[model samples]
Target: KLRIRTPITTRMTGCPNGCARPYVAEIGLVGNGPNMYQLWLGASANQTRLAWVFQERMNLDDFERTLEPIFIEYKKSKRRAESFGDFCDRAGKEELERVVNEFDPSQSLVKTTAKPRVSVTTETMDRLTRISDIRGLSPSKLANEILEQYIDSLETTVHAQK
Candidate 1:
């Protein structure tokens, strides 16, 4: 017999920037505020990885009230020892969207605004050039590496404090 384990874990408050690797969990509830949450679902160890943002800015009270029924349905229909991610893959995105819409009716049809591009001035370019020369790398390559490291460090610091 294959024994399955399901545990509900909690993180006080944090952002999902892959620093904490929240997408690896079966059910991840991220705090958006005092009483708001963003629910992440269907993450697993298999390479078939995708975590859908089920709800955004959902009131914690509302989430608690709504989650039980959905979970019950999953439990009832789940295959013998099928993981949450497997179940979600089998269920498909449309069904997941339907489930989420039932909880938060006012689904934002609007797409997220794209981040404004940072124009690289001469001063910025010169600084990047100097760093690249010192590191023996091309300016473009150095810039990319620097940006990646900077973002990772920022996320780590932010999560550490939380």
Candidate 2:
């Protein structure tokens, strides 16, 4: 006899990008604002596919009501150990579209807008120079190595706390 672990799904809110990367989890909820959310479903292990935007700017009340049924249906129909992404794919595009549309008709027309590019400033240049001085390396060399390492460490520390 073999025991199987059920697929786990997780939700997070208030992330800057609303956790659009579906591959990151079986179910991911990203906050669009105070009472709005974006949904993502899937995992990267299969193919690194992203969840299609199911609904954009959904009110919290509507999200709770609409998502419950969809998840319930998924649980009922899903093959043993099937991930949400794989389930969606197996269920086909029409079914996924129906679910998204049933929750919010606007979902069909909603498009994710690209964020504006940021320009580096003189202040950033000075900071880079300071880092180079501290590391006893040229700006180009420090930029390639120590700067990324320093930033990555900071991010790691912050993420660890969360």
Candidate 3:
């Protein structure tokens, strides 16, 4: 179904030995257990980079249902005649992960809990409160926004260095 609906190659194996060359396939599935596999994606076109495992485990029965929506996005939004490897590269891992998240059959498998309270110096807390008040947001939300921006900048810097 994956090959029929999308122009990407998929390779699967029944064990972690990776004999199927899942590292180079557009969609790599290495078995984790009976009827279960670990999913990977974003291998470079030249096979210079191995795919990254995004899902640690998933049932084979969930494949089509989970991946079809992602293929639909690729079909509707990709450049004309772009191969899945190139499309995955162009879309970037984060965006593709967002598409995959929509069809996650194990959504409820993850336990959701309120974020734990973070420890901060009194000065930092006061500053955050003041900035958040001016921005019309809760202190926690403002702090999250600030952290996300910092992480983005840090990631860009780290990637640039490498």
Candidate 4:
């Protein structure tokens, strides 16, 4: 589990069906119910390993309390541009547990589900699958928008002619 991260991204999900695929996310949180989430970490982005359960049945307050100190320690411990999942894998379970146990939740600043969800082009999805990485945003949104503008312009010209 000490290998380098193949991708650099994060994700979140509110679906019980695991729509966000938290099982393989570097930092994945699945919503169990109102204000309750399950935390998973140390997953390889390339789907090489399913993430381990770092914590379960966490409330917003608990999420904040549990994650902040680990983040701080990661900041101190990580190599250049290393990701959370990669850091988690290299740090090992015992060390992560030690950090989790030591962190005081009172100091947490962001105490809720905080990762972004984005849509992408099918082409982008294909590239992601090919590359073993998950960049959160999609280039297709922009492409679709521009295509709409072009269509509108064409329609305007046809309408004027008619």
Model number with the top TM-score? 4
**Model 3 agreement with the true structure over 50-101: per-residue lDDT tens digits:** 7887678878766765566567667767787676766777787778778867
Name the top lDDT candidate: 3
lDDT (10s digit) by residue, model 1, range 1-162: 122364433223476565555565556677777768787667654535756666766776566444553564466677887776667667765786666457443432323344344569999999999989999999988878988999999999999999
| Candidate 3 local Cα displacement, residue 16, angstroms | 1.1
Per-residue accuracy of model 4 over 1-162 as CA lDDT, tens digit each: 223343644667998687878888888888878878888888876768778878777886576667777777777798887777878988987899899898766655554556555667888768655544344445455445556899999999999999
Question: Which parts of model 4 have CA positions greater than 4 angstroms off?
Answer: 1-8, 104-162
| Clashing residue pairs found in predicted model 4 | none
**Please, what is the TM-score per model?**
0.49, 0.46, 0.54, 0.55
Candidate 3: segments with Cα more than 4 A from true spot: 1-7, 103-162
Model 3 residue 40 lDDT score? 81
Better of 1 and 2 by TM-score: 1
TM-score of 2: 0.46
The per-prediction tally of clashing pairs is 0, 0, 0, 0
**Predicted candidate 2 versus true structure: per-residue lDDT over 1-162, tens digit per residue:** 112246455656677554444336555677888878776655433556655556666776665455554565566688877776677657764676576456653432223343344446889879989988988888777666855799899999999999
What is the C-alpha local distance difference test score of each model? Answer: 0.64, 0.62, 0.76, 0.74
Error of 3 at 47 (Å): 2.8
